[model samples]
Target: MLFYNDYPLPLLGWGKLRNRFLPDKGKIMTQAIFKATIIAAAAVFFAIFVAVVVPPLIAQPDVVGAFAAGFVNPYASGYSSDVLACWVILAAWIAYEAKALGIRHGWICALLGIIPGVAVGFALYLLLRMRQLKAG
Candidate 1:
C-alpha cells in the first residue's frame, strides 16, 4: 500500500480516488446546459427589451406613460393584465420557496419582474432555485 498526504491509498483500484476527486461528467454537462438555458432566456428577454422599448424610452423618457400605454387598447390591456398577474404569481412563489428552499435574493427578481417583465425574472429565479437545490 502507498500513502498520499498521510492517507493510505486504496489497495483494490484507483477508481475510488477518481470518484472521490472528480464529479460525474454527464452531471456536469447537464448542469452547465441547464444554467446556460436560464441565462440565455434572460439575455434574450433583455435584448427584446432593448429593441422594442429602448427607442421610445429614450425619446419620451416617461416611465409612467410607458406603463400606462400598455393598456391603451383592449388587446394591450389583456396582455398587460396577464403580465401583472404573472408577476404576482412569481412573487408568491418566490416568497414561498424562500422559506421552503432557503432561496435568498428572490425579492430582486420580483422587482425585476415588474420592470423588465416576467421572462427575465422567472429565468433568474429558476437559476437561483437550481443553485440552491443543488447546494442542498
Candidate 2:
C-alpha cells in the first residue's frame, strides 16, 4: 500500500484518490471546493453583468435595444452566438439531468441564464446538481 500525507492508500490502487485515502473527509473536501468554485464563478459573472449591463439598463431602460447591442458588430455577434449556443446546451443538459437525477428547480437556472447570463445559471445548476447528488 502507498501512503499520501500520512494516510494509507487502499490496496485497490489508483482508481480514486478519495476512495483510497481519507474516504469521507476527502469527499467532503472535494465537495466544498466544488461549491466554492461554483459560487466564485457566479460572483465574477454577476459582477460583470452589473458593471456592463446595469448602467445602460438604469440610464435608458431600453430592453430591446440592450439585447440588440449584443449583436451590434461581427465580434459581438460571434460572442452573442456562442452564448446562445451555450444556453441551449445548458438547457438540454438541465432537462436531461432533471429526468435522470431527479434534480428540481432547474427552471430557475434557465431563467437566470437569460437574465444575468449563462455563467451564473450554469454555476447555479452545478450547485443544484451537487446537492442532489449528495442527497442521493
Candidate 3:
C-alpha cells in the first residue's frame, strides 16, 4: 500500500520550506523602522552639536582654529555657490539611485552617503523613503 497521502504536505511539514523561501515581514519592518529612527535622531543631535558647540569651539580654535580659518577664509568668495553645487550633485545621485533601485536600496545608498555630512545624508534618506512602496 502507498504510504503517502493526498495533500502535498501538512503545514507543519512545510515549515522548513517556508523558512527557506520567505522572510518574516513583521520583523523586517520593525528593523527598518528602528534604523530610520536612529538615523533621524542622530541627525538632530548632530545639528544641535554643530550649532551650539561648533561656534564656541571655533572661537578658541587651537589647531582646529587654524584649519577652519584656512579653509573657510579661502573659499569665502563663492562658498554658497560651491555648497549649492555639492548639494545638487548629491541630489542627482540620490535620484538616480531611487530610479534604478527600489526605495529601500536607495535608502541604503543614502545612509552610506552620509559620510559626506549629516544634512546630505538625512536629505537622501528622507527622499528615498518618501515613496512607500517596495520595489519588485
Candidate 4:
C-alpha cells in the first residue's frame, strides 16, 4: 500500500537552520511557560505574606519580645539574629525550589524570596524582574 502522510512540509527555502531548530521550539515554549507560572505564583505568595503577616508581628513589642526570649535569647543578640535566621532559611528554600525548577539564576530567586521576609517580597520581585530584563 502506498499512502501519503498528511503533514505539511517546511518550505523549500528554509535551509538547514530551519530544520535544526524547529523541533525543539515546542519544548522550549512549554518550559518557558512553566517557569513563568512558577515564578509568578511564588512572587504573589511571597508578597502577600510579607505585606499582610509581617507588619503586625513587628509592631507588637510584647510578641516580638516573647519570640526573642523563646527563640533568640540563647543564640546571641536576639531579635536581629532570629530575623537573619529566618531570612537565611527563606533564601535557602527559594534557592532549592529554583534549582529544582531549572531556573538559570537561583540567587535572584532567593533574593526575591527574601522580600517577604522583610515584608516587601512582592515589590522586590517586580523590581528584580525589571532589573534583570534591563541587564540582560
Candidate 5:
C-alpha cells in the first residue's frame, strides 16, 4: 500500500499469493481427528493383547512357555498368529520408511511400539514422522 496526494492504493503482491494458497479452515480439526483416532485405536489394541496374554501366563508355571504361547499351541490361534506376524512385518517396513525419511528417534519409537503392539508403534512412528515432515 502507498499513499500519494493523501490517497491510498494497495498492491496485489506476494501477500495475496501466500494467503490465497494457504489453507485456513479445518486444519485444526484434521489434526485433532488424527490424534483422537490414534489414541483410541492404540488403547483398544493394548487391552486386547493384555486379555489374550495374561490369563495364559497366570495359568502356566513356566514364564518362557507362557510368553511363548503367543507363537504356539492352544494359547494362540492361527488367526492370532497371522495377525501378529503381519504386525511384525508392517513394523519392519515402517522402520525402514522412518529411516529413509530421516526421522529422529525413529528406531526407538519403532522398537517400543512394535514390541508392545504394532498399532502403538506405527501410530507413534507416524506421529513422529508428521512432526518431522512439518519441521522440514
Candidate 6:
C-alpha cells in the first residue's frame, strides 16, 4: 500500500501535514497550536453570528414563518438546499480524513459541530487534530 510518507510537509499548513505524520514531540506543540487556532476560530464565528445572523432573526416579525419561507419555499430554497448539501459533503470529508489519520475524537467533534453549525464542527475537528498533524 502506498502512503504519503515521501511527501514534504509544510510548516504552517495544516491540511496535508495534519493527516500524514507526527514529530516525536509533536503532541505538546500541536496542543498549543490547536488551542490558538480554536480560540481564533471561535471568536470569528461568534463575531459573525452576533453581527450578521442575529440582526436578521431579530428583525423578523414571525421567526418561524421566516424560516419556513426561506427553507420550505422552493423559490427561496434552492440556494439553502445547495448549502446544506455542501455541509453534508464537508462532514463526510472531515469524517473520512479523521479516520485515515487515526485521530481520536475527531469524528465526535465534527458531528457535534454540525449540531450548532458546520463552522463549529470544522473548528472542533481542527482543534482535535493536532496530534495527528504534528511533524518534526
Judging by lDDT against the true structure, name the best candidate: 2
Clashes of each: 0, 0, 0, 2, 1, 2
* RMSD to the hidden true structure, all candidates: 11.0, 6.6, 12.1, 12.7, 12.0, 10.4
- lDDT measured at residue 75 in model 4 versus the true structure, 0 to 100: 54
The parts of candidate 3 lying over 4 Å away from their true place are 1-26, 31-39, 44-48, 51-53, 57-92, 95-116, 131-136
Candidate 3 vs 5: which has more lDDT: 5
Candidate 3 local Cα displacement, residue 27, angstroms: 2.9
Which pairs, if any, clash in model 3? Answer: none
Task: Report the Cα lDDT for residue 94, model 1.
Answer: 100
Off by over 4 Å in 6: 1-38, 47-79
lDDT of 6 at 62: 75
- Worst 10-residue lDDT window, candidate 1: 19-28
lDDT of each: 0.87, 0.88, 0.56, 0.55, 0.69, 0.65
Rank the models by TM-score, top first. 2, 1, 5, 6, 4, 3
Off by over 4 Å in 4: 1-29, 61-136
lDDT of 6 by residue, 1-136 (tens): 2323444555565676556555444444665676887778877886786687677777876756755665776767997677567678777777787568766666676565544456677676776665567841
Model 6: residue 54 alpha-carbon error in angstroms: 9.0
Task: Candidate 2: list runs displaced more than 4 Å.
Answer: 1-29
Cα lDDT tens digits for candidate 1, 1-136: 7655445667677767656765555544686788888789889989999899999999999999999999999999999999999999999999999998789999999988977889999998998888778898
User: What is the C-alpha local distance difference test score of candidate 4?
Assistant: 0.55
TM-score of each: 0.72, 0.76, 0.30, 0.31, 0.57, 0.46
Query: In model 5, how large is the Cα lDDT of residue 133?
Result: 84
Please report the TM-score between candidate 5 and the true structure: 0.57
lDDT of 5 by residue, 36-123 (tens): 8987888888788688866666687677765465667654667567757877776677667757876777676667654566777777
lDDT of candidate 2 at residue 50, scale 0 to 100 = 98
Q: Sorted on lDDT, highest at the top, how do the candidates line up?
A: 2, 1, 5, 6, 3, 4
